[model samples]
Structures are given as structure tokens and as C-alpha cells.
Target: MQTVKNFSDAELITAIKTGTNIDNAVGFIYRSYYRMLENFVLTNSGNEMDAEDIIQEVLVVFIDIVQTQRYRNEASVRSFLYTLTRNLWISELRKRNSDSKRNGFFEASREKEEEDVSDFLIYKEAQVLIVELFERMGEKCKQILTLFYYENLSMKEILKQTSYENEQVLRNRKYKCLKELTDIIQQSPTIINNVKSALQRSK
Candidate 1:
């Protein structure tokens, strides 16, 4: 069996709050709480990958909590970590469940009054279709469109995030992606009708 090192709760909290020996603190967390978190996720419909991702995010949230003075000794560090893991896993599960439920909602919702601008079905359908379209696109196209349209990242900022050789190439790629996406939307009568209906309702 491999030996895992441990850190006292107070010592760990102090290191994170003061931003000192942070790497060691993170390592300690992985070494100590990893199995407990992994088991919790495994039993909760989460896979190994999910466990890994949750562990990474939990550490980030934990550090933030400690640094922001949210850790006021109200709970033991182990308990806090366990709580964070449970909440995060539950949130992930909810998002998955909602996505499953959304398909039914989208299909059933068209019967509602289109004149109501706030009709949940039409708006949600449009948004969901946009996501579906993006998923069908190439990775670079999806990235460019997402950064520009959704994230509102500037060309220069996107350049930093992407491996494009220059701004012109990046912009050109974005344009092509946009054009492709637009063509797709136009080809889909269902998407087009829903979007137009939503727009008309809003106007």
C-alpha cells in the first residue's frame, strides 16, 4: 500500500487563506479526501471521470471558501469537503435531469399561446437548438462561435485562448462558422419557425 501524507485541518485552512504552501495543501487534499469523494461519486451514478472532475472543482471551491473568510470553524474540514462534494454531485445530477426533462418540455410547450413573449417553451427550444447546432459543428468552429457570440470575447482575447496563427485567420474561421450555423438554421424549418415565432412574440 502507498503511504499518503496528511495535514491538520487548521494548518490546511491557514495555508489556503494566506496563500502560502498552496500546492502542498492541494496535494494533501487529493491524497487524503480523494477516496472518500471517489466512493461517494461512484455510488451516486457518477463515473471515474466525474469523480476526478468533481474533486478538481471541489478543491477550487474549498480554496476560495477559505480565502474569502467563509471558513469560520463552524464545521470540520472533512465535513465541509464532504458537503461540497455532495452538493456539487447533486447539482451535476440536476443539470443532467433537467436536460432530459427539457426535450419533453420543448416539444409539449408549442401548444401554449405564442402571443405571450415570455412563453418558456419557445425561448428554451431556440436556446437548446443553438446548443445542438454548435455540437454538430467542428471543434474550432464551435470554439470560435462560443467565444465570440456567447462569451463576448474579443478577437485578441480569443487569439490568446486559441492556437490560431493570427487574428485574420481567427476572424475568418468565426465568419465561416457563423455562416455554416446560419445555413443550418435556415435549413431546419422547425428551428426557423420557432425562432421567428419567439422573435415576433418579443416584438
Candidate 2:
């Protein structure tokens, strides 16, 4: 029987990027990271099926990251994959909670912390209106964007606050939140005008 070759981060990434023994590269990742990643999901309010799904999804994304030249060598491939897996599972938790509470979560969140996360975009009546829009999102997003726009923290700082395992993971979360917020603002004429008016006043 043949065996999957062990690869250092550099070697594995090179193989993936250069299309050398791509199958073996994948096999190495599965053998190396699947149990670790799957354990993360299993311990984090997920079932076996959920763990399997998350690990599979993480591998696909990790491979895509390599293929696209987006893999940064700052962290080991294992560490990066673990961070990716953990972040993804965290996101999946948010998603599952949001889905389960879709009917009332927004209103409930508002009731819990309507006054908190104030000065969300920046302090002002206009920003208050903006804050209201942010309130419609999930709690994780609210925390992430607030740290980003309000506290003006770097990704590393935000990771410390949010417990994100990697800067890239936090960056990805922030991007999605911003995109969602942008979509919401675009759909609202009142918010669009208020944002413009606020900028005009600030300038």
C-alpha cells in the first residue's frame, strides 16, 4: 500500500501551487487536519455530520486559497488551516443561530442592547440611524464592525477582542459584514441620504 507523503507548509503549498502531485497534497491535508478540525466542530455545538461538512468545506477553501496565490506563509499550513477551520465553525454557529431565530432574533437583539453599540459608525443623529441598520445584523457582526469602525482597531487587535484565530479570518468576517451593511444601506433611501448628509456636515 502506498502512503501519503508528509509535507512541510512550504512544500505542501508549493505542490498545490505548482500542480505537482495535487492528489497527494490533498490526501496529506485530509489525513493531517481533518481530525483536528472535526474535533473543533464536534466540541463547538456541532454533530458528527456537521464536523464532516465543515472540514470538507474548509479543505475546499484552503485549496482554493492556494490555487489563487492567496496563501500567506506567515503561519504554518496547519495553523492556517486550523484557524480557518475554527473561524468557519464559529461562523457556522452564527449562521445556525441566525437561521433558528430568523423570525425574532433581530428584534430580540435590539431589545437586549439597543442602547449599546452606540456611536456604531460615529456619534451623531445620522450615525444613530446607521446604528439602527447595524442592529439588524447578528451579534458577531455587530461586535466585529464596531471594533473596526468605532474603535478603529487593526485586524490583530480585533482578533484579540473577538477571539478570531487569525487575521485573515477576521478580515474575511469584516468583509462579509461590510458587504451586508452596504447592501442594507443601498436599499434604504433614508440611510443613503443620511449618510451623505452626515459626510457633508463632517467635511
Candidate 3:
């Protein structure tokens, strides 16, 4: 196990591959890349939890690739990690936009420099989708879902905040709202395809 001060990317990868435990590698990956990955995801309209999940997923992918002998190290580990993160985020944004029926939000033009325009566009589009999706949901349903998922609030906290009559009521409403969102996602072909591709890639 490599500590924070001495851990390098190679050492971390080795720990991930052969070590009985990989906490050290996980910590090294988090310490080294968390900030950059967080900035990239948050800049692209994801919240804190989204950034956390994506970064963790990136590490999972790195380990998977290494174990499968698919990581050739053609590029620096940092470059490969960044590219994977970028692609995943782009796929997520595409799903969100397609789910919301907002196709023209992203421009097709390319810039000479590696501009972060797509990040900004994704955030903007996400905000729009969030608003539209919540609007489609009733106020009570929207508030319940947002508190539970987005704010990470407990159901007890939500009941107190929203003055829901009981736990059963809150749970029922949350389930229905989530079902609606799931149905909406299922109806979107692009989102369904992206979900399928993501699952396949993971396997």
C-alpha cells in the first residue's frame, strides 16, 4: 500500500491489480484525480454526488481495463483517465438532452482549441431538463423527489420539512415520482441506447 506522499500512478495501478486490498489505490486515485474530475463534472452541470460517482466509476474502469489487459498505456494514465471521464460525461449529457427533447442545445461547430463549450452547454441543457421534468411532475411529487435524491435528505427530514402526513405517504409519493421519471427515460430512445451501451461497456 502506497501512502499519499509516495504513491505514483504506476504504484497505484499495481496495487489495484495484484494487492489483496485496493484501498490504498482507491485513496491514491481519489487524492490525485478527484479535484480535476469533480471540476469537469460540476462544470458540465452535474452536482456534487454526480461528480463523486463519475470519479469512482473512472477508477473502476481503470482497474477493469488493467485486469483485462486492455490498458496499453499508449497515453499517460492521466490522459486515458481524463478521456474516459470526458466520454462518460458526454454520454450522460446526451441522454439528459434526449430525455428532455432538447436536441438543438448543443452546437456542432468545433474549435481549434480544446474549448469547454460542451461542458457549459451540458450544464445549461441539464438545468432546462430539470426544470421541464419537474414541471411535468406535480409540485408535491417534484419536491419529494428533489429532497430525497438531489438534496440527499432523509425521508424523515422530508416529512418534517414538507409536512407530509406520514412516512407511508412520503414513500408512496417518492415511488410514484421516481416511476414517472423512469418511464420518461424509458421513452427516450437515445437515453435507452446510452444506458444499454454503458451497461455493455461495463460488462
Candidate 4:
């Protein structure tokens, strides 16, 4: 196998920002960080697949931060990357613990250091709740809402993809679906509490 090229902190940041040499930079990042992060997750009650998924998600967030010039040079890129990945994994653990509690399973205790990740964990919890509530919506509502909001499709584009008779009808359906989702969210005490907690943490 060919050796993947390595990148220094400056080199990697430059490549990511300029959108050039990105493939090699990303390859280097994965090769360099994967094993360490994988070992961390595996030791912390997660499996290899969980480590892979968490790394992928954290990489996406890292890339976005780099692209948007939001990455401060306060720390080395590797350290920053590892911190983000660790925080994300901790949030995942907290979410899983919450699920286990709901199922009457034994919940694991978290470390004091993990409490620092509560803001992110709360945000992630609210996000999961929204997704769950969205899935509980009617199939038609799900489709139209996804096409319009998540997919960022225009009304005309949605009409083409869907079997809607006209843009107006699709618009009406979208409004109703949104209202339904909003009502469902409003009625969900768990979601309400999570959102409130997230907001308070943000403040």
C-alpha cells in the first residue's frame, strides 16, 4: 500500500481552507487520528463502529470549522481535533445513558470532567428528540417537510419530486405539516425540557 502523505498543522489548515490538496489532507487526518480515537472509544464502552461513526461526524464538523475560518489557532490542529472528537463521544455516551434509563437498564456513571460537555450534550439531545418527533409524523408530512426543509428544495422542485397537483397545494401541505410538527413538539414535555435546558446552558 502507498503511504499516505502527512501534513503539518499549518499545511493542513492551508489545504483545507484553500480547498486544494484536501483529499490528501483528509487522508492524513484519518490515518493519523483514527487509531487513537478508536482506542479511546473502545475503552469507554463503545465499539469500533461507534468510534468510526464518531470520527466521521467530528471530521465533518472540523472541516466546516476550518472552511468557515472559525478555527482559532489556540491549539495545534491535532489537539483541537481530538478534543472535538472526545466531546462528541462523551455526548453520545450521555445520550445512550439517557436511552438506557428510559428502558430501565443500568446507566453508567460519568466522570466529573464529562460535566464540561453538558452544553453540547443538551444540544445533541434536543436534536435527537426533534428527529424522533419528526419520524413520528405522518409519512406525507415527513416527505414534504424533508424535501422542503432538509433537502432545501423549492416548492416547484418539491412538486416535481412529489405527486402534488400544484405549488399552492404543496405549499398548503407544507404549512400544515409544519404546524403539525410544531404542535407535536409543543406537546412533548421531554422535548420541551431538553430544549429549555439547552437554551439555559447556552446562556
Candidate 5:
């Protein structure tokens, strides 16, 4: 895997188009966009499973275009991939809702406002770390933390959702889950500092 440096989008495209194979090309795309796509999916009403499936679909679509020599350099490859993934996710949500009897409606899309490239990079890295930390926790921890933090549901809401007997039990579980997440963040010094820098830079 070659490290993706400062290659202009045009140069990368040319290399990809002329190379004997697509391994490097695919890796470059993954390294550049995987975190952004994952964060977009997870933050936009997608679960980890949904995010994984969507990313795979995005890669498949990208590869198909590349193999068919159809990826024009009219726009940055990054923008093209992001738009493709976004459209695919929207299409998937419509399909899912159409197939199921669920009553909840999909919310409006949240487009990330453009920021300094460095800040965007760090913010994305932080999100990736948080997602990994959540995945590493126990199932109970994941559910509790996600309800309180990611879903922004109140204690009563969490209690009802989890079917807990009382508020006290819910509070205890929430505290424990949050503590575990904090510990995970504390352990990753590089990620913590990077995120801090990103936030500071944004301000």
C-alpha cells in the first residue's frame, strides 16, 4: 500500500487508468475516503452494520466505474465518490422504508460545511476512533451509550427503549457505559490530541 501523499487528483487518475492493475488505485481511494464515508453514514441515522454495507456498496460502485474507464476527472475524485455514496445511501433508505412497516421518517440530510482541510482530517479521525471504541464495548454498553450519546435520547427515553425496571438502573448503566467510552478515549493519546487540535483549529 503506497502512502497517499500530495498527488494531484489528475495524476492519481492517470496512474489508475494506466496501471496494469487496480490495487493501488483502490487502496488510495479507501485511505482517503473511508473515514469520511463511515462518519457520514453513522451520523446520518445509520448503524454500524448499515455503514459497513453502504461503504462496501460505495466501493463496488467506484470500482465498477474505474474498471469501465468511466471515472472522468471533471470533478475531484473525492467529491464524486462522496456524492455517489450519499445518493446510494438515500436510495437504500428509501428501499428499506418501502419494504418495512416502520413509521419513523428519514430526516433531512446533514451536509458537513466545508472547513480547513487539516481540521476536516482530524475531525474525521476522531469520529473513526469513537466508532471503533463503541464497537469494542460490550453489547449492553453499546446500546446504553448509543441511546444516550449518539441518539441523544433522554434517560426516560432510554429506560423505555431498553425496558429497564427503573431510572436508577438506567442511570447506573449509562454512567458505566460513558465511563468505558471515556477510558477508551483517554487511552488513545494520539487520537485525543489530534481531535483536540482539530477542534481548536476549527475555532
Candidate 6:
């Protein structure tokens, strides 16, 4: 049998960001984090299968965050993965009316401080909606928005990278792309409410 090599936090982030060796990275994540999280869920009124589903969903969210360059490297990859998996499992337990006493015990035993789960869920929901809206946009709009917002490129830098002839043209296109995204977001009442709730929580 072959062994999968583990990646350092930096190495994992690079692999995910560049779309390089992602399979190896993902395999490493499963081999490393799955059992620990499975045990966690199983002890907290969930079965092995439920743990698997929760871990899978956490990986999806982790990959999306990495791809979007939203991960701040404030914590090690392992720590981040564990935190997300734990929170997700807790959310699931709450939904299923699991043993509250067991849930409280497990939650209290965790080493890290508890995150605001409601805020985390709201943010994730909004992120999904934003990603969907971005995908539905035209290629040009996607490129412009990605450059300006995600990549944090200046107007001049954007013009240099893109086919737009002038800064003014790029700026106008950016405005339209933003407006288009806003329109798409407005169509989703759930997203709007989540965004509002998140904002209120932040305030």
C-alpha cells in the first residue's frame, strides 16, 4: 500500500490556489482529519455516516475559501479544518434535536474558543450566493470583478492586464458588473436577509 504525504499549511494553500496537485492535497486532508472528526461526531449523538457527510461538506467549504483567496493564514490548515468540521457537526446536531447535554459537553471540551456559529453560517450562505452570481455573469464581468475585488488590482493595473483601452472604460465596466451582481443578489430574499443579519451582528 502507498502512503499519501502530508502538506504543510503553506504547501496546501499553494496547491489549492494554483490548482496544482489538488488530488494529493485532498487525499491528505481526508487521511489526516477524517478520523478525528468522525470520532467527534460519533460521540455527540451522530453516526459514522453523518460524520462523513459533515466532513465532506467542510472540505467543500474549505476548498471554496482557498480558491477565492479568502483564507487569511491566521491558523494552521489542520486547525482551520478541525474548527470548520466541529462547527458544522454542531449545527447538524442542533438541527436533528440531538442530545443537548452531550452536545454541550463536546462543545465545552474543544480546545479553541467557540466561534459565533450563526455569523459563520450567514457568511457562508452569502458567499455561496455571491459565487453563484459571479458564475452567471459574463466572462468579462467576472474577470474585471475578480481583478478589482479579489485580486485587489488598481484601475491602471487592471487596464494593463485586460483588453480595456483606458482606465475610464475599465471603471465603467466595473460599475456595470457590480450593478449586475447587486441585481442578482436582490432577487434572493434569503441571501438578502442573511446579509442583513450578518451586518447587524457585525455592528
Model 6 TM-score relative to the real fold: 0.57
The C-alpha lDDT values of all candidates are 0.66, 0.64, 0.59, 0.66, 0.60, 0.68
User: Model 2 clash pairs?
Assistant: none
Error of 4 at 124 (Å): 9.0
Please report the TM-score between candidate 2 and the true structure. 0.48
Top candidate, metric TM-score: 6
Worst ten in a row by lDDT for model 5: 113-122
Instruction: Write model 6 residue lDDT over 1-203, tens digit each, in one string.
Output: 88768898899899877779988998888888888878878886777766766676677667755654457676778778777877776655544455654456564655432343334544654554456667878999988867754554655678899998876677667766765765565567676665556546553
Q: lDDT per residue, candidate 5, 160-181, as tens digits?
A: 8886798667766665665565
RMSD of 5: 17.1
Stretch of 10 with least lDDT, candidate 2: 112-121
Query: How well is each residue in 1-203 modelled by candidate 1, as lDDT tens digits?
Result: 95655689998998877768877888988888899999988987778867876676567656645653446576677777776776656555644554553344334433222223123223433465567778978998988767754665656789999999987677566656765765566567776666556555644
RMSD of 1: 16.6
* Index of the highest-lDDT prediction: 6
lDDT of 2 by residue, 1-203 (tens): 97658988888999877779878988988888888888877766677866765676566556645654446576677777776666555455554444552343233333212232222212432456657877988899998867655555655667888878876677667667765765576567777677657645653
Q: How well is each residue in 125-165 modelled by candidate 3, as lDDT tens digits?
A: 34444456566677888887677545646556788988779
TM-score ranking from best candidate downward: 6, 4, 1, 2, 3, 5
Checking candidate 5 for backbone clashes, the offending pairs are none
> Model 5, stretches more than 4 Å misplaced?
1-7, 19-21, 98-203
Location of the lowest summed lDDT over 10 successive residues in candidate 3: 112-121
Task: List ranges where model 6 is wrong by over 4 Å.
Answer: 1-3, 99-118, 126-203
